[model samples]
Each structure stands twice: as C-alpha cells, then as structure tokens.
Target: MNGLLRFSRGVDWVNAQVGKYIIWLILASTVVSGVNAVVRKLFNMSSNAFLEVQWYLFAAAFLVAAGYTLLHQEHVKIDVLSSRLSKRGQIWVDIIGFTFFLTPICLAILWYGIPFFLQGWRSGEMSNNAGGLVRWPVYAMIPLGFTLLMLQGWSELIKRIAFLQGRIEDPTAKRAEKSAEEELAESIRRLAEAEADAGKKAD
Candidate 1:
C-alpha cells in the first residue's frame, strides 16, 4: 500500500506537470487563430495550412489535456445523485467508476487509437485539404492522452483506497488552491496597480 501510494504520487506529479505545460498550447492556438483571422481579413490571403494548423493546435491542446483535466477534478460531472452520498460512499462511487467505466473506456480507445496512429504514420498520411498538415500527430494524441488519463484513474483509485484505510486524508478534499482564472485576475490587478503608481510618479 505504501509503495502503491508512492506510485500514485508519481502519477499525480506527472499529470500536474502536464497540466502546467499544456496551458501554453491553448495560448499558442489562440495566437494562431488570431493571426490567421487577421491575415485573411486584412491581406485577403490565406492558406489551408494556416486554417488547418489552428485546428491542429486546438486538437493537440484539447486531446492532450484530458488527463490534466481529470487530475484537477475539473471535468464536468453530474453531481445530482452522488452529491447526496456519504464521504465513503462517494469515494466508492469514484472507485467503481474509475475501475469499471473510466479505465475500460480508455483501454478501448487506446486499443483502436494506437493502430489508427500507426497506419497514418506508416502511410505518411497528409490532410485531404491542399497545403494542410500531416495527420499522424493528431492521431497520436488519441492514444497518448487516453494512456495518461488511465494512469490518472489508477492514481485516483490508489488515493481513495488509502483514504479508506486510514493511511491518508479524504481523497476528494479539494486543495486550497486558486484556479488559473483567479491567479490571472490577481496578476492583472497587480499590474493595474503598478501602472497607476507609475502614472502618479510621472505626474
């Protein structure tokens, strides 16, 4: 159990790092889309490559961030029924869901996705759209993302079990952590204050 807990922590660390870095992909996608839109509207020019790259970035960010989303417990959930359960009951629900549903679905996706990626890579599959990017990279995300998600599911299972056994605190207890939005808002506020102070000094 101690060994398993260590493994769970390692998994959590991996997903945590992934979550931290994947935010940059979202920013990159936004930049790409904005640039593509500006170029098309202003220059009256565009390439399928430009259009295709936006969705490629989007797909990469969205698919690759699955485990990170799960790790943060940010994934949408129907809490209508489970919200009423006792703490232990809720943990059991998660364990069953992770074991029976989440893991199997991830496995099924990986079983199909790995071959899908392999076929595309072997054939050097390019986009049907002219000047578009190759397809295998996006295809590869399917398996890679699911594999991370599955590992996260196991980590969550370990945490829940350890909690039940009195080896750890409640697994569902959210950490006292501000969300990204909150952090960004705070940073913006500080920047605004700094600019205001600079203006006063200039005066």
Candidate 2:
C-alpha cells in the first residue's frame, strides 16, 4: 500500500511537469497564431504551414493536458452537497460517486478512444480541409490522451480507497488538483495584457 501511494505521488509529479509543458504549448501556439495573422496582413504573405501547425499544436496541448488536469482534481465536480457533509460522509459520497459515475466513464473513454485512434491510424487519415496546412497524424492524440486520463483515474481511485480505509483524511484527500477555470482565466488575462501592450507600442 505504501509503495502504491509512492507510485501515485510519482504519477502526480510527472503530471505536474506535463501541466507545465501544456502551459508552454498554449503560449507558443498563441504566439504563432498572432504572428501568423500579423505577417499575412502586414507583409501580404503567410504560411498555411504555420497556421496549420498552430491547430495541431493546440490540439496536442489540450489532449496531453487532460491527465494533469485530472491529477490536480481541476475537473468540475458538484461539491455543493458534499461540502456540507461530514468528513466520513464526504468520503462515502466520493467513494460512491467515483465508483458509480467516474469509473465507468473513464473506462469507456479508454475502451472507445483506443479503437477510434486505431482506425484513424490504420486508414492513414489526414485533415479533411483543403486549405488546412498541418498534416501531422491526428490518430496518436486520442490513445495517448485517453491512456493518461486512465492513469489519472487509477490514481484517484487509489487515493479514494485510502480515504475509505481511513489512512488519509477526507478533507485533505486531494490538495494538489488546481482549478482549470482559474488557470485559463489567468492565461487569458496575461494574453490580453500582452496584446494591449503591443497595440500601445504600435501607436
């Protein structure tokens, strides 16, 4: 059990690093997109290649970040009722909710997403858009994303079991998961500021 706990922590740590990478991805994608548009307007030139690359980059960032999001418990939860319950009661709710609702959903993603990606890979599928520039494989992200989400689900299950067994307090069950909305809002704010500053310099 201790070994499992350590392993789960290790997963969390890895996911944290992955989360950082996703942030960088968002930053890079945003930069490329802005530059792409500016270059096309100002220079009367643009790379369909660069524009297409931005889409794939954004998609990759989103798919890869799912696990880290889950690890942080940043995914939305209806905790209104649970918040009013006692620690033990909360634990029961978590156990039941996770078991009945979450587990099946996670497993379904793993089951269906695998074959979905496989079909894409087997068919050598490419972007259907004629003007679309990015042609990197789309099939890889599904399996990769689903697998990471599955790992995160397993980690959550482990922690929930610990809570049930009384090895850990329910109140502190998931202290690591950050809110996705909070992070996104911050990112948007930062981007808006950067855009405003750039506009001022141009004037």
Question: Cα lDDT of model 1 overall?
Answer: 0.87
Give the worst 10-residue stretch by lDDT in candidate 2: 130-139
By lDDT, the best candidate is 1
Stretches of candidate 1 off by over 4 Å are 181-203
User: C-alpha displacement of 6 in model 1, angstroms?
Assistant: 0.8
lDDT of every predicted structure (CA atoms):
0.87, 0.73
- Model 2 lDDT tens row, 71-182: 7666787788779998778667766766787678778876887787777667666666656642335456766776677677666767878867777655345565446556
TM-score of each: 0.88, 0.73
